[model samples]
Target: MNKLILSAAALALMAGAATADTVRMGTEGAYPPYNFIDDDGEVAGFEREVGDELCARAELTCEWVTNEWDTIIPNLVSGNYDTIIAGMSITDERDEVIDFTQNYYPPTASAYATLTEGADMMGGVIAAQTSTIQAGYVAETGATLVEFATLDDTIAAVKNGEVDGVFADKDALVPFVEEQGFMFAGDDVPLGGGIGLGVRESDTELKDKFNAAIDSMKADGSLNALLVKYFGDETAQY
Candidate 1:
């Protein structure tokens, strides 16, 4: 009789907690095609679209919140937001601090953008956004790593010759390479598992809901359509 009572109570708690509150989707609104602040000063990008759909699928009310990339995780942990839907790659190092849902974006490569060809990739001074995987990789490559608060600063460092190269996501570098004539230096370095929604470790129920939504999108092919829509035809799909 006691065991039956406890189980029923647990189930009741779970039911009541479903969609408990409005989930705040946190992101760095500077990474284009992922998340960005548009001309109207509102969050507008692939992540905004995906996040809204996920909330609908999960039956949760949601809101958008933008934060600086360097402080995004800390603010999430501090309850400034409920989830990190930014284009954040999952890694073992970060997983220690917070929990991640199943990957939404596929694994991609980090590349070096230099003004000239044949720039020394391994030993050259490189600029990368602070607190990023690219910054960590640059520090490990026997190169002097210059950290910047934003991606634009890294690209500017490259143009002004403050650094020999700037290392970042290949998708992000594509525009500069095509328009500004920055050439890729050295081989592309594959890093991280993939991109995922991040939530506090204690928010397992919230995580599960998002995981289910991602699975649904992947199963129905809507996720791949979004990828191609924002990242172009050649981008890796679900």
Candidate 2:
């Protein structure tokens, strides 16, 4: 009888340990105002703050890790990260590989041309990051597509006249064009996806927790507050 009691206690303890959740979050720290490294070398941005709030709401300890943009999803699938809080778009193509939590943010794509006299004449080729929904849009629109590795590179190509215009996330591109003296075209293009938290397909429980936390934040206006604080009132979607 004692042995049976001991076995049950051991199993209970193991179960408790298993449920001590730790959410390992991944992001592209290079994207400013979304997820970036501050002067203190700590991750600080809109996405980071949102992720921290979600973790608190979900009662999980979170560890923020920086991963390259291209590898974020693959790393999550390979068990290198438990969650992806990057400004990753939710697309049907991505849904085939991983599950996404409720959208915490909405992002649009727009085209920006260099500040030149005939910039309006430069309206043929559109540039975007390779493998992104923006790139797919460019392709579907039949625009001459120029692919770059990073957002900065795409903007640089536009500035240097290598491309006619650059298509990118509205939040990032707006500030970038203002700082770089580029002119934003009035395209108002819609992207093919929405931004959401990413998780492995096997992590249904974690995904549900994240979705609940996001829903709560959205209801309480915390998500909108963060969006306004970082991207301004024009960018607020929820």
lDDT per model, in order? 0.92, 0.81
Pairs of residues clashing in candidate 2: none
Q: Which digits, one per residue and each the tens of the lDDT, describe model 1 over residues 1-238?
A: 9999999999999987774768999999988878889999999888999999999999889889999999999999999999999889999999999999999999999899999788887888999999999999999988999999888999999989999999999988988888898999888899999899999999999999999999999999999999888888998898
For model 1, what is the error of residue 111's alpha carbon versus the real structure, in angstroms, after optimal superposition?
A: 0.8
> Which pairs of residues have clashing backbones in candidate 1?
none
Q: What is the clash count for each candidate, in the order shown?
A: 0, 0
CA RMSD (A), model 2: 3.3
Best by TM-score: 1
Model 2 weakest lDDT span, ten residues long: 114-123
Prediction 1 global C-alpha lDDT: 0.92
